[model samples]
Target: MKTLYIDCFCGAAGDMLLGALIEAGADYEAISKALNSLGVDGYTLSCEKVNKHGTMATKFDVHVDDAHDHPHRHLRHIVEIIEAGDLPKEVKEASLETFRRIAECEAEVHGTTIERVHFHEVGAVDSIVDIVGVHLALHQLQPERIVSSALHVGSGTVKCAHGVMPVPAPATVLLLRGVPSYSGDVDGELVTPTGAALVAQVADEFGPMPHMRINTVGVGSGTKDLPDRPNVLRVMWGDAVGDFHTKESITVIEANIDDMNPELLPPLLEDLLESGARDAFITPILGKKGRPAHLITVLADDKKVSAVTDTLLRGSSTLGVRMRKEQRICLERDWKHVLTPWGDVRVKIGTYKGTTSTTSPEYEDCARVAREGGVTTREVYESAYAAAIKGEYKDA
Candidate 1:
């Protein structure tokens, strides 16, 4: 599968993401054409090759005309602007999703609703172009999946429209609720609200750069001078290996809790998943005091080990947790559509040793079909499986 890995050692902003995409082979002319089609004039986009520290990178900038003075815009206004644009549906939706996420997080941080939230810096013409142009560029690359490194949020306070606030800013912190992040070796706001929103909305997974063959590298420079590191974001585009079999390392974190309320367990599991745990479960156990207790375990990547551990400790009534590294083998999997008698069902096909090893209809698909056809979900599953076995679908 086509994959893009974002190395955010210097954190990400919308323009930085755009620059990286262009440097990684996305067409600049195509992006400009799409932005023009938006009909939101008064901004000029440009990129130039620059050297940061010792690494060459692309620096992207959007110069907006001072005459165009739409400083603050509501969520509806931004949505209308995006919807009226003539860009591709994917570009429009992706851009809208990014803006919407920012609006939601801003509203939550400021004690308002999405409808009432006002986007200040995010609503500027330059930022609008940066956000929309990013989606346009990403559409051209067409990576099947995107992964990112933990964000370096930077330290120190930042002065913004909302007055002086801690580093990462309130909106940025809200957007990065579930994502893994850290304060890097810098004393400035490394991550802007726009940058945090872009990654929070677009990234499919967050962890270390996965195992893959190198294809191309793109470096985007940030407009800053740091004492300890170069201000740049690196993105790598590559193809994940074939053959369907893969092995990777993961961390298993476990804790025993007997005092936490049982009612809170469900939300704890959900929180763990949202916090990037591959899996989380609870097992009944007997504690040292002979009291019935629960053992909670979470499986996650090494990058997420610290964040997941913190979540377990805070969300549950546990003072400490145990963790260990383990390896897991998994088959490469893809979805296939099977035409059943009642409806079309999605079947998961797992490949191992370059051969198809397992086929199963997605339970959610089966259940939906069963509900519509007035039959048992098992019937839908059996029919879909039979269809797969009979090669009823072309892909099957």
Candidate 2:
């Protein structure tokens, strides 16, 4: 599997992330042309080689005309600006969701609604370019997995549009909630609000670099060099170095519900899956006072745990959910299409050490084909299995 690892030993910012992506193989000219159409004006994008301490890195820049005249934009305004241009659906949606994440954090910090909370630094043309550029670059790279090292959020006080605040400003702190991060020895604001949102929301898991055959290493320079460190963000792009099985840390959320109507459980499960949950199920249980209850168990990527937790709390009778980190081993899985007598059936094939270990025909596909062909699902399944056997499916 193709993977991208973010090394935040120094820190991360929107520009830094974009710079890393560009240096890692994202097309800069394409990103520039896309930004030119982003509807927000008065900004020209540029990238150049910069020396961060003794090492060289790419520095992404956005030169905004009349920087003082830029408006403090609200969430709606920023959305309009992003929506005004032609962009890939994935990039556009991801970019919008990122802004929403930031806006939500800002609203929480300032005690205001997301719609009413106006962005100060984040609203500027330059920051807008940085966010959009980062998304565009990711779209271009199309990595199957994005992992980040624990963020090194610098220490000490820093001044921002919100006045003097501690390192990791209020919005930054709120954004980094539940994310693995630590304050480094540097005394300054290393992770900006945009940086925190980008990394926290984008990375599926936070830890040291996973096992991978290293490819290109892109170093992105910060605004200024630090005396102790190189002050650069490194992006490692490579293929997963696995023994056909991979290990990952997942967040498991569980809650016991006895008060909510039983009919609501299915839809809640569906909602959880739609909101980034990997698996969501309910099991029957006898609760306090011997009341019949359903135990809701949710599994999700570390990045999606917060949304899954919210869904569990607000979408069900459970007042709160318990979360725990658990490591899981997964086989290398891929899909194969089998031509059944009734119709085509999709088969999920799991492999280990380059050997096919298991195959499961998609029940929904088999059932649909059976229904269309006026046959039993069992017959369809058998025929699908026979066809797959003849094809001798191989690992993807």
Candidate 3:
């Protein structure tokens, strides 16, 4: 499968992302044609090769007429603009989703509803084009999976519509809540709201670039030319290397508790899982006092360990939780929809060594179909599995 990895060494912006994709071989003329269809006047996109700190890169620029001063727009207005634009269905949806998230974050930061929230810098014509252009570019690439590295957010102060604000302004901070980030020696905002929203919207996972055979690489230049650092974003496209099927290392946390109430266990587990625990389970155990205890275990990525541990401590009466790193070997997995007598069920197919080794129907999908068809989940699972074995649905 093809994958796209974003290296946010100097952080990412919507224009940078779109520019890198175009440089990596997305059709520039097609993107230009689509933008022209938007019908908004007084703005044009310019793409060119530039050298940044000794590295050649593509610089995307949105030139707007000085006569047209853009006013801040509300969420609904932005949505209407996107809806009226002539963009492909997938591109339209992705772009709208990115904008919606930014609006929601702004609303939350100001304690207002999405309808009442007004766009600040993000509502400008340049930012709008950047985001929409990014969506169209991503549609052309059609990567199977998207990953990113830890974001580099610069420190110090920044001037905004709301006056001077600290680096990683309120909305930017809200957008980057769960993503790994750091602010350092750089004396200005490295990640903008548009940039943060784009990354948070599309990134499937954030960490180091995994093992892969790189097919193409593109460097996207940012507007600000810092003296100490290259203001650029790197995009890499490739296939996974080696067996590629081997799962990366993940952190697993386990805790044994005999003193906590059995009734309290369910909610604690739910909280942990909801807070990003990959999986949580309990196993019966005997404590020092010969009392039966529950062994609670949580599997999660490295970034989620702290949050999951916090939830456990706050929700349960545990003195300590044991943590360890372990390797999990997972068969390459993908999803497919299968038609059964009841309804459509989503099936998960796991491939090992390039052959289907296991097939299972998603329980939630089965439950939903069973509820609508007035049957049991078991019946749905069975029907879906049987259909898969019979080649009713092909691999996704």
Candidate 4:
């Protein structure tokens, strides 16, 4: 399948992402036209070929000629600006979604609602164009998967709307919670909040570049030309050598606790699941003291072991937990939208050797429907599952 691999060696920004796409064979003229269609004037895009550390790259510059920097904007104002734009429906929707993700990240960091969140640099005209432009370019590519290298958030401090702050900025840090990142010798805000939001929203996997036939390469130059490092973002597009297969070992943890309050089990299980446990549950057990206990079990990948274990220890009254590496054979999974009485639920269909094996609705989606429809989560899940099965048969 066709795929795009983003080499974030120098870190990524909204403009850098767009520049990389343009370098990777995206039509500059077409993209410019699309940006203009948004009806936001006072900004211009300049594209050029430049060399970074002896490597040739495309550099896209979004120039704003205002005498003073644009002030921060509220989430509603930003949304209104996007809604007023004359871009295509898909482009508009994608851009809005990216902005929404940014707002949500900011809200979480500042402990405020999304509507009350204000964007600083991200609300500027140039940044908005960069974000919306990147979305449009990505939609044009439509690759099967998008992957990125671990982000390099530079060291030291940077200025923001909130005054001088440490490198990575609070909002950017919040946006990159689950993504792999690190700080290096470089000293600056390498990854901006807008950049982090975009990557976190779209990146399917975070690791080394996968095995693919290199078709195109693009390099986006950053504003600062660091003396020691090439300030650029690399985008590579190609086809993988073999059928995509992910191979990794996982750990299964189990512990029996007899003294925990039964009422706390539900919240504890929720915490574990949210903390990256693949699965968590409790089973009734008769303890050695002849007292009743609940057997807590968790399945998680190695990277999540600590958080999973911490959740168990902090949320439950378990004295000790046992963990062991277990061999797990998992089929390839894909998502499909299934229409149910409550709403549309995303169903995950698992296939082994090209044959369907298992199907389930996403828990969050089912739970939302359950709350809305005043029914058990199982009821919503079963309804969605049945609908998916019917749809699969119809397709067959």
Candidate 5:
């Protein structure tokens, strides 16, 4: 699968994302033409390479002519502008959703209803261009998945239309709910409202850089240069290259239990699996005094680690559970049905790259067919394997 990882060490803005995407191979002319079709007046878009500290990056600017007197618009006005544009349907919907979220945030911040909210800076021509251009660029790139790093929301107060407020303005604060963010070393508004909204809308997951083969790296410069670090956002376009599988980080929880009944272990395992454990098993171990103990181990995704741990603690006689992280690779798998003389057996096909590496017939299907045919399960399995090898499966 294709992946795009956004490195927001300096935080992200809409213009920065657009610039980085364009540099990462999104067609600039397509983005420009799409924006021009909107027929919004009094603004011009330009992109150029610039140096920030020592790293060269693209600077995307939307120069708006204030002399044209663009009016402060409401949420409905912005929605109308985006709806009238000739762009991708998904792009229009995403842009509209972004504006709606901002309107909601603003409404909450100012104690007004969404309909009564008046957008000041966000309704301006530059912000509109930045937001629309970003969606256009992302659509052009067409990555299968998009990931981002934790945002570095800078410290210190920022002066806005609402007067001096905290580092992340009220609207930005409201927009970045549930997203991983921190007060960065540089003191300024690192993440803008438009940037925060885009991140919330587009990023599929947030953490460290994912395990992807980096193909192209594009850097976008921020407006201000920071003291200790380069103020730039990086867009990495790459394929999720793997040996035989994709990689992900998982948590392993283990507990030593000698007091619990071995007969109850199966039920405890069932509960753990039901509670979101990827895998659960027990191992025989010698305790400190040579007593035989069962080591209960569970593999879980990060989000489900707590639940798995709770199940281990509550369902077993273990006082505490120890946890650790592990990196695991999973083969891409799909189901195909292979026809046998008795019945159809579903087979799991595991692939690496484009080549099939392994195949396994559904044991339950084989067993059922074996009973009906008065044959051994081994014989049914053999027939299924032969059918699979003979390409008896209907679908790929």
Candidate 6:
């Protein structure tokens, strides 16, 4: 599968992300034409090669006309502008999702509804271009998966419409919920609201760069002079090396509880999955004193370990939890919808080297159909499985 990895060594911003995509071989004219097609005027997009410290990188800039100075805009207005624009369906959806994330954060920070929240910096014409153009560039790349490293949010304070605020700004910090990030050595605002929203929207997994065969690398330089490190973001285009299905990492967290209520274990498992655990379950075991106990195990990616671990600790009576990192192999898989006698059921198809290896019905869909049809879930599963095996399932 084709994959794109973002390396935020210094930090990221809207312009910086676009620059990286351009450096990674995105068509600049096509992106500009897309922005123009939006029917929003008074801005020009420009790119040039520049030196950041000793490394050469591309610098992206948006020059907006003074005549189009509208500093504040409501979330609904921004949504309407995007919906009316002439853009690819995928581009429009991705752009709208990013903007929605920003609005949600702003609303939470200001204690207001999303519609009532007023956007200052992010609602500007230049920011609109950056966010929409970034999605357009991503659509051109056609990556099957996108991964990113832990973000390096800078230190110190930044002045915004809300006056002087701590580094990572209020909106930025809120958007970074569940994202892995840390303050860098630099003393300034590194991750902007636009950058935070973009990354939070696009990135599928976050941690160290995964193992892949490098095809190309792009360096996007931010327009800032820092005392500690070069202000730049690196993007890499590549494919998985060796057996693509064999390389993956997951953290296994386990805790043995003897005092927790047995009835609460089910809800704890649900909480763990809701908190981003890949999987969670409990196994009956015996404690040291020969008492019956439960062993809670949670499987999660490295980025979600903290959140999942917290859930495990808070929901269980265990004093300590053990953790071990393990590698897992998975088959390439996708979903399909099968038309059953009663309704459409979702099926999971696993493939290996262009051949189907396994076919199974989605349990949630089967359960729902069974409840409505007054039948057993097993019957629904068998029907869907047969349909999938006979190549009778249609793509949803």
Residue lDDT tens for model 1, 332-356: 6667899887898998887776678
TM-score of each: 0.64, 0.69, 0.64, 0.62, 0.65, 0.64
Cα-based lDDT for every prediction? 0.84, 0.86, 0.84, 0.81, 0.85, 0.85
- Give per-model CA RMSD: 10.3, 5.7, 9.9, 11.1, 12.1, 10.6
For candidate 1, the C-alpha RMSD (Å) to the true structure equals 10.3
Which TM-score value belongs to model 3?
Answer: 0.64
- Candidate 1 deviant stretches above 4 angstroms: 242-396
lDDT by residue (1-396, candidate 6, tens digit) is: 567999987888998999999999899899988788877778787899998888888998889888875658888888888888888865776787788889999998999999998878899898999999899989898775689888899999999988999998998999999889999678899899999989877886887877777888988889897665678999999765446534567899999899988889999999999776889988999999999998899998664676788888888888989999898777666678998877889898776666778898999999999999999999998999889888996873
lDDT of 2 by residue, 1-396 (tens): 678999998989999999999999999999999988886767677799988888999999988788546889899998898898788765776788789989999999889899998889987887888888898998898776799999999999998886899998889999999899999789998998899999987897788888877788888888966886788999999877676327777889999999999989999998898776889999999999899999999998765676678778889988888889898887766678988767788987777766777888889999999999999999999887877767644332
- Candidate 2: misplaced stretches above 4 Å? 243-245, 248-329, 333-351, 354-396
**How far out, in Å, is residue 76 in model 4?**
1.9
Where is the poorest 10-residue window by lDDT in model 1? 240-249
lDDT of candidate 5 over 105-181, digit per residue (tens): 99999999988888898888888888998888887877656789999999999998889999888899999999999
Clashes of 2: 0
Off by over 4 Å in 4: 68-71, 245-396
Q: Kindly provide the TM-score of model 1 when superposed on the true structure, using C-alpha atoms.
A: 0.64
Candidate 3 shows a clash count of: 0
| Preferred candidate (lDDT higher): 1 or 4 | 1
- lDDT score for residue 132 of model 3: 90
* Structure candidate 5, residue pairs in collision: none
> In model 4, what lDDT does residue 359 have?
86
